[model samples]
Target: DRVQIINDGKFIFSDTIAGLNKQRQAFNLLCTLLAPPSVTSLQKISGVTAVETLSPSQFCLHYQPDLNPTAELLNLAVTQNWQLTELMPEQHSLEDVFMNIIQQEQESATVEQII
Candidate 1:
């Protein structure tokens, strides 16, 4: 499946399957979780605006904004094994800019709100 990454220049937010605690998974059910922490720490830099997950493990990160491509970031990509890419938005809406990949199945229940 093609993964969608929603983030600005310095922050990323992704979706996580609600209640699928990674802490309590077997050897297989647990997906390979990725985050900026392991990347940034090893790379050595600062500032995290946000972090989210798509599905249970897939997520993205927005590197430092308004700074020269730091050696650390490059090293992070190489060392941490993070595949980097640039995303261009068709719309500039704030919602579109800053949203995680929430499940439509969960959304359906919210739409069916009963009073």
Candidate 2:
């Protein structure tokens, strides 16, 4: 089956389920630590695009799907002695995709207004 996503009356995405799944671009890593790692440090890593800190011990690491940094991230955690509690791919449901698209559009619009 196929699905399409529309935002602001504009067609944003059209693809099969598998294709949508392939669009996933992030992983969620939860750890038990005294302090969270530096977001700047993580973003400097190759393929890492963004780091969202859910809490001092939880982070959503966004990266290029093609150049996954999971291995490097895990290695850093081990070298730093972080007690990992959970590490999993970010499951993108249909709603999540739609929201992502909408949020991107909104952010771009805001940037445009500033420019």
Candidate topping TM-score: 2
lDDT score of model 1? 0.36
The residue pairs in collision within model 2 are none
- Per-residue accuracy of model 2 over 9-76 as CA lDDT, tens digit each: 88877898788887653454433444446778777767788888878777777777677777887787
lDDT of each: 0.36, 0.72
Give per-residue lDDT, candidate 2, residue 36. 49
Regions of candidate 2 where Cα sits further than 4 Å from its true position: 1-17, 23-35, 97-115
RMSD after Cα superposition, model 2: 5.8
lDDT of 1 by residue, 39-105 (tens): 3343234333333343433433333344323354456656766553422212223343333223443
RMSD after CA superposition, every candidate: 15.7, 5.8
